[model samples]
Target: MDPGGRVNIFVDTFAWFTDPAHYTGSNAVQVRVFEHLELSALAVLIAAAIALPIGLYLGHTGRLAFIALNVANVGRALPSLALLAFALPIAFSLGLGLGFWPTLISLIPLALPPIMTNAYVGIRGVDRDVIEAARGMGLSEPGILRTVEAPLALPLILSGLRTASVNVVATATLGALVAGGGLGRYIVDGLALQEYDRLFAGALLVATLAILVEVAFGRFEARAVSPGLRSPADAL
Candidate 1:
């Protein structure tokens, strides 16, 4: 084969996406990819459900703020792969099995920090005068939170969600380490077989997917923060 012909081999790996003979286009790949996406989404959603409320409470009360902030910091400091390795044994012990749940558990710590930090910062960043004005208008604490503070903080909170979502999507590739299933399967297998073309295909697919999700979430976030506001400053 000529140089160009040889290069074509690497490019042709993407054809596996449509090739029934390869795992990438087979049922196993479909099942694994879907499972990985579902697990990542579920973990992030759960983390958001828990983190947002706590963050808001800490931001508003100005109590336990340090604790919440430090927890997020520590979470960010921990390496994701190390956490995954650690969770593997624990998950097996708990009878959650060795595959999906353990991998999902590892991703939670990776996903939480951005959501919590952004939520806390967003709420706390709201103007004190606006908060006082809400109180002056006889708005209850919850009312202030719902109508005043949350509205102001919405943009920042969404920003955090956007960050968290992207992080989870990228990190979810590690799921394959535990046989939890994802595009990572191709990468690991490719490395084992010395198949650079297959590895490249997996990496390309992952990057493309991550970018697409990030862009989609960013648009959704923009809408969530402000239905009418088109610009960041206006949303804030």
Candidate 2:
């Protein structure tokens, strides 16, 4: 489009963002943003709860590497939209219907692979010297993992979380497909109405959220790493 058209979209987006109807009223942008946040958080938390332990254990032991392999394959093979469609039918059969639960179920898988892979890789990547030193210090396996390895692996773990969280947030836009009502409501409504202004607003909002999520995670990852991992200048 022309520069004028692009500028108009920006203007329209600003209007949508600032409008009281999209903020203070029922089913407004404010409400939708929270809905999106909640849905994304639930998916990420569930995935992390399950995937992190499995990945950490596998990474630490270097066993059942195939599990990560399989998960990666599944993640690669199925797009989130396809997963949501697949789950919708399955959920209906289970009497979960086509709404929040189905959307959550579908989106959880989208969050899993990165989390599991990162946890596994992070743990596995820890220095042999550190592992040996911890072992030599009479640290039990559990003790060593908790006290020595976990802190070191945290950066990568967070990196995985960062990736997963961003992906989940972006994908939650698909929730609108299932009537799951998120920030995506605007997009769907905009498309159905052929309202390019609302379309641009919704797209901008999601993109902004994804970028913010990434930046926040990046900051947390840097700050969260063990001091030992930092260079002298950084630590100082």
Candidate 3:
């Protein structure tokens, strides 16, 4: 588009944001924002629950490492839209209906890979000598994981959550396409109505939210990880 067109779009987006009509009732921007965050948070939490244990077990026991690797690969390969499409039917069969369940279910896969991979890699990558030393000190297997390996691996484990959180937040926009609510409603509706401002505003909102989540996670990682335990890159 021309520069003039771009400028006009920005101006119109500003107008859309300022319009009071967009802030009330069920389709309000705040409501949509809440919906977006709620869906994204639920997806990430669920994914972490399912992936972390398996990754931790595999990483700790040094068995079935292939599962983590394969799961990560498959999750990365699966398209979010395709997963949403695949989930729609399953959701209906289970009487879960539309909006939340289908969208939330689809997003879980998008979050799984990073979390699982990080948890496994983080735990598995812990210095073997440290583990041996813990054992030498008479720590049991569970004690070693809880006290020794997990603490050292916490940064990377948290890194996976960071990645998953951002991914879920951004991709949650797709939920709007499946009769779900979120900032994406603006984009989908805008395109259909030929309202470029709404489309741009929606895109901008999603981007802003994603960036904020990333920054929040970054701060959290800094505080959560011990200065001594942080990787060299992190330390810098």
Candidate 4:
């Protein structure tokens, strides 16, 4: 159509978002937005649960560093779309539920690399002199990890988690392609209907959510990091 036709369509879609009737109810965009938020949150939490400990262990042990780093690198290299495609058949064969589970599986591989790499770096980056001091004081391996290494490494580890969280939040949108419901449904539906306005709105909302989560977690990370690790001036 003409530019005027496109302009009118945009105006109408904008009006829909503002219209109370369209903003409320089971069918509303608002509901779908919340669903997206919930899905992203759950997936990130589960991913963190799996990634953090393994990352920490890999970092502390040093023996597994090569394997962990390689796995993470492979995760980074693999496309989520490809991963999801491979997971779908396995998921079906195992009788695991589709949609969210497969989506979650796809995301875990995507999320792990940053966490593992960061944890390894953070631990390895600790001041060797400090580590030596701790060992000189009779600290066991576990003791050194818990009291010295992990605390020192926390800020960096959190940085990695932050990166993973944001990536998962954005990638979760792909879930809609496989009938995994989220805000992505809006984008997919809008695309199918050739509704550019709705598609842009969905994309905008996803960007906003990602930024919000990153900012919120960043503050939490700053607060949660061990006091000893903070610079002397900043710690005060």
The TM-score values for the models, in the order shown, are 0.88, 0.94, 0.95, 0.88
Report the C-alpha lDDT of model 2 over 1-236, residue by residue, as the tens digit. Answer: 59998888888778877887766765777788888999999999999998899888898899989866596659756988889988898889899876688999998888888999888889899999999999998999988778877888899899999999999999898988888888888888899899877888888889989999999998887777878798999879
Q: Which candidate model has the greater lDDT, 2 or 3?
A: 3
Q: Cα RMSD to native, each candidate? A: 3.0, 1.6, 1.9, 2.5
Give one clash count per candidate, in the order shown: 0, 0, 0, 0
Which segments of candidate 2 are over 4 A away from where they belong?
none
Candidate 1 lDDT at 40 equals 75
TM-score of 4: 0.88
Q: Model 1, range 72-156, lDDT digits (tens) per residue? A: 8787999889989988998999999976888888888887888988888988998899899989989999999998888888888
Cα deviation at 207, candidate 3, in Å, is 0.4
| Top candidate by lDDT | 3
Which candidate has the highest TM-score of all? 3
List pairs with backbone clashes in candidate 3.
Answer: none
The TM-score of predicted model 3 comes to 0.95
For each candidate, the alpha-carbon lDDT, in order, equals: 0.80, 0.86, 0.91, 0.82
Which stretches of candidate 4 lie above 4 Å from their native place? 1-13, 233-236
Please give the lDDT score at residue 153 for candidate 3: 86
Query: For candidate 2, what is the TM-score?
Result: 0.94
